[model samples]
Target: MSLIHVNDDNFASMVQKGGVTMAEFGAPWCPPCKVLLPILEELSAELGDSVPILTVDVDESPVSAGRFGVMAMPTVIVFHDGEPVEKLVGLRSKAAYAAVLAKAAALSPESPAAAR
Candidate 1:
């Protein structure tokens, strides 16, 4: 699956949807964010349709960034049922992201992963 691009217009609705939503908040120029992209992509692939992974450019979507209190680039947030359950900053390993996804899935009542 591909990463969904989120903006101020759709950010609220995207994360507010039931189940697990992973939102990566960063800018194009951020080096750490750039490094994190492929890792998240890999994690998304591993998770398949169990979780939705989203990317939001802080430069283009300041409203959503500010709302989430994103003080730095490469902020990854795992939202469960519209509430943020995990927040990570900087570049992290794919394993770390997988752990977060696992937590999100376990917490989401709508996730089929929870049945596994």
Candidate 2:
């Protein structure tokens, strides 16, 4: 599956859905956020429908960030179903993101949206 961009309108449904969702909380002004987009896309393509990669722009959706208690930009929060499974804050490498995704993939009981 392709990446899902989360906003105020879709936040509830995105979080409540089944399967693995890796939500990236980012701000357009942040340089690291720009660097991470392609990496996210690659990961999303690699994972396919088994896991869905979701991105939430902090500048676009402050409410979502506040709800997630995100104090910083570029926060990567992974969820299984309606619950959180893993979180990574600040700038990180593609390997790091993959490592977290791998953990989420292994830990999640059901197949990820990307794998589907």
Candidate 3:
């Protein structure tokens, strides 16, 4: 799993990097965030080198989370080439989130990944 931990400092690059990215906006104390952790891990592992999955601790870097307009814990946002294209709040199944990723991947300009 390619999980990059982001704080106030590294959020810009994390969001603006190439390819599709699924970034989880969460707080350490949020139970739903804890629940979604494993699903993100499995997603990162399964997606291999194609898409990147990252975690943002809102408690530490509220700026990034706020910039993305993440108003709640366990919010998932998909960014493609630095622009957000989709968002989901609360806990969601892997398949549901995967569909979001698939759509983001397909929508990215010049991205070669096939939409599933």
Instruction: Give the number of the best model, judged by lDDT.
Output: 1
lDDT of 1 at 76: 94
Candidate of highest TM-score: 1
Per-structure clash totals for the candidates: 0, 12, 0
Model 1 lDDT, full chain set: 0.86
Candidate 1 lands at a TM-score of 0.91
Each prediction's TM-score versus the true structure: 0.91, 0.87, 0.90
* Residue range with the least summed lDDT across 10 consecutive positions in model 3: 107-116
Model 3, backbone clash pairs (residues 3+ apart or across chains), number: 0
Q: In candidate 1, what residue range of length 10 has the lowest lDDT sum?
A: 107-116
Candidate 2 per-residue lDDT over residues 8-113, each given as its tens digit: 7788787646566789999778998898889999988887767778899988898988988899879999887768888899888989988877776666555653
Model 2 TM-score, all chains together: 0.87
lDDT of candidate 3 over 6-90, digit per residue (tens)? 8889877767567788899998799999999989998888887678788999989878888889898899999888888899999
Q: Tell me the spans in candidate 3 whose CA falls farther than 4 Å from its real position.
A: 109-112
Sum up the clashes in candidate 1: 0
In order, the Cα lDDT scores of the candidates are: 0.86, 0.81, 0.84
| Superior by TM-score: candidate 1 or candidate 2 | 1
